[model samples]
Target: MYSHLLIPIDGSPLSMGAMQTAMAFARDAGAEVTVLTVVEPFHIFTVSPEQLQAKRGEYERQARAHAADLLAAAEREAKLLGVRCEVVQVESDDPYLVIVETASKRGCDLIAMASHGRRGIAALLLGSVTLKVLTHSKVPVLVYR
Candidate 1:
């Protein structure tokens, strides 16, 4: 049985669904869950420092706010399920790597997340963070598709 579970979410319907499922699983196992939301740094090709500064600041604010909202909702749900929960937010260009590292650092026995179910060219272009986490993480991953 898992003593701790790490659930990474992107605020998507799929990820939210997975989070709910993982929360239930954690409650059943008498395990706590850490809900993680990784906000990617804003990327832009602006030569003007003023524009870059302003836009990047705005993006950062919005991203963190959204992450906060998501985490709050998750916390409420966890409370309703009577499961202990911890929430974390971080900025990283590589969210998948962050997820793996956080799982290890938090001593999580399992990493549960949703898969986007990408295929072929679309997957190649957009890339799949879930796939990367599965490939790179040493912790066991439970993928919800």
Candidate 2:
């Protein structure tokens, strides 16, 4: 019943699987897809202020390029499936916030994402963005593990 789907990609194999799943779902539902890739802002606390400022631009550029490439692949796959796709790249320290905001702002009816299935200490330390999105997003979330 979803007319618009939002899919977040991290360029991992699991994320790719989610992309494929979302594509098929979108095709079947006759829905448009919005592919989002969030890039983490660069942080180097050890560096001096000047050094950090100098390197920030380059770091951000590289990150944006990587995100764009990831979104491009998703777009291509969705196009092949005859699904309309839009790509978004955002730079944020809190990806979950960006994901939720983008979903709401874009008027997506559903968010389809992949969970890394991290558990125990790893999950505690790194934290799961998908989990955060599910917790915070107002829109419906469809997580593919």
Candidate 3:
């Protein structure tokens, strides 16, 4: 019953599976898809201004390139499924915030993403983005392991 689906990808194998599942669901529901990849902002202390600027530029370039590659593959998959798709790449320190905000801004009814399945201390240390998104997002979330 969803009209628009938002799928977040991190280039992980699990995320790829989520993408496939989301695409199939979108095709079945005649829904368009929006794929999002959030790149973390580069930050470092104890660096000269010039060095900091150079490093920041380099980091952004590399991150955008990686996001583009990931989004391209998703786009190709959507095309194969005959589903309309759009791609978004954003820089944010908090990916969950970006995912939630993008879903709201794009008017998506559903969010489909993969959980890294981290648990216990690892989950506490590495903070699951999927969990955060589920907690914070108003849109319906369908998570795939």
Candidate 4:
């Protein structure tokens, strides 16, 4: 039933696993794929405006480049299955919110993402972005671990 699928990738091996799963699903369902990458915003409280500007720009550039590469790779895989695909990069400090919002705005029916598999102290301190997404998202989410 999912026609427009949103796949959020962070260029990690875990996320790559999710991408593969999403690609397979899309191929079977004849759905279009929307690959999204989010770049966290600058921390204004920690850094000055000027400093944040340069650092944010650098990070954004790197994030965009990485997203482009990921999208390209995913696109190649989708092409082999003869499926349609599109790529988008979003800038936001709240990755979960951005992913949810983008999926809603794009009319995606489902979100397919990879879990980093964080646990214990790391998960507590860093928190789970995928968890936040699952909690906040109104649409269906298929998490790939």
Error (Å) of candidate 3 at residue 54 is 9.7
lDDT of 1: 0.88
RMSD of each: 4.2, 4.2, 4.4, 4.0
Residue pairs clashing, model 1: none
Could you give candidate 3's per-residue lDDT for residues 30-143 as a string of tens digits? 999999988766778623343376677887787788889999999999999999999999988788999999999999999999986323353577688888999999999999
Candidate 1, residue 19: CA error in Å? Answer: 0.3
Runs of candidate 3 with Cα error greater than 4 angstroms are: 45-54, 117-123
What local lDDT does model 3 show for residue 49? 45
User: Clashing pairs in model 4?
Assistant: none
Better of 2 and 4 by lDDT: 2
Clashing pairs in 3: none
Worst 10 residues of 1 by lDDT: 117-126
Instruction: Please give the TM-score that candidate 2 achieves against the real structure.
Output: 0.86
What lDDT tens digits, residue by residue, belong to model 4 across residues 5-123?
99988778888879888989998998998988775555646433433556667765765776688888888878887879888877776778988998999999999998763233545
What candidate 2 gets wrong by more than 4 Å, as runs, is 46-54, 117-123
Q: If scored against the real structure, what TM-score would every candidate get?
A: 0.88, 0.86, 0.86, 0.82
lDDT on C-alpha atoms for all candidate structures:
0.88, 0.85, 0.87, 0.81
